[model samples]
Each structure stands twice: as structure tokens, then as C-alpha cells.
Target: MQLEPDDSQSDRPVPSLAAPEFAAGDRVRMNALGRSRHPRYGERQAVVVRKVAANGWRVLFEGRTSLLTIHRDYLEKVEPV
Candidate 1:
């Protein structure tokens, strides 16, 4: 007797582009520098994990996970850090 094979896991399609919108608890990169309290004011590397306002976001800096509120003008999408 002969047996038949199955192929049921190769019919789904993958996404091409992602939607534009930053949410809380999301990891993102700093694009530009707008304003800050630090002496070294500028687009320093950081992560987005909180939403402060309609066009604002809270990010976590290197070596730490503390959320820091910042405006959208001070952020830019970047590769995972």
C-alpha cells in the first residue's frame, strides 16, 4: 500500500509594511533631539514604553528601564537596541 503527504501550513500570507503609530510599551529608537533636562540635550538613544500625550512618548534610556516623557518631535524610529 502507498500513503499520501499533507501540506496545510503554507497557505498564509505575510505582512509587507507595518502601520504608522507608536504605542506605550513599544521599543523604538531616537531620531532627533527636541528638548530635555540633561546637560547633553540631543536625540540620545532610548526606547518607547509609555504614552504621555497625542504626540508625546515616554522612553527608557540605556542601562535603565525608567520611562521618560518626551515629545514626538524628539523621537525617530530606529533599529532594535
Candidate 2:
């Protein structure tokens, strides 16, 4: 499913226009500087398992077993040619 802009945001950071719509099975990469303290922060890539919200996604990071809900700001769509 695609993300719709969240007009309910109060103090939260708004989602960027550059952030692509995510779907299950799509490959994505986590920003190296995103979520510095997250356990999966070291992982460079992941698969989008679900879009949890307009700004969050459930991802399965490469080399990891557990699924992590990472914000969309930290992910970029990996369009394969």
C-alpha cells in the first residue's frame, strides 16, 4: 500500500516527498545515519514487509531474524533495473 500524507502530525517530523511508497517484497535500504541506536542500524538493507503507518514500516533487515518497525524517513526504495 502507498503512504498518504499525515495531516495529523503535531510535533512529529513530516514525511519527505522523496520517500517512495513501499509494498511488501520491495527492497529498501536503511539510511546509515538513521536511528543510530536501533539494533538493526548496522544493516544496510532490508525488505519491506508492511507499511505500519504513513511514516513507519515493518522491515526485515538483511542478516537479521526479527522484524523491526523502522520509520520511512530511514528507508529508500531500491528500484532494480
TM-score of each: 0.49, 0.65
Model 1, stretches more than 4 Å misplaced?
Answer: 1-20, 33-43
**Best by the lDDT measure:** 2
Worst 10 residues of 2 by lDDT: 31-40
Every candidate's CA RMSD: 15.3, 7.9
lDDT of 1 by residue, 1-81 (tens): 887655675432222244236765565655423433343535456767767656667788776657677656555566564
Best by TM-score: 2
* Model 2: residue 18 alpha-carbon error in angstroms: 4.5
Count backbone clashes in candidate 1.
2
Against the true structure, candidate 2 has what lDDT?
0.76
Clash count per candidate: 2, 0
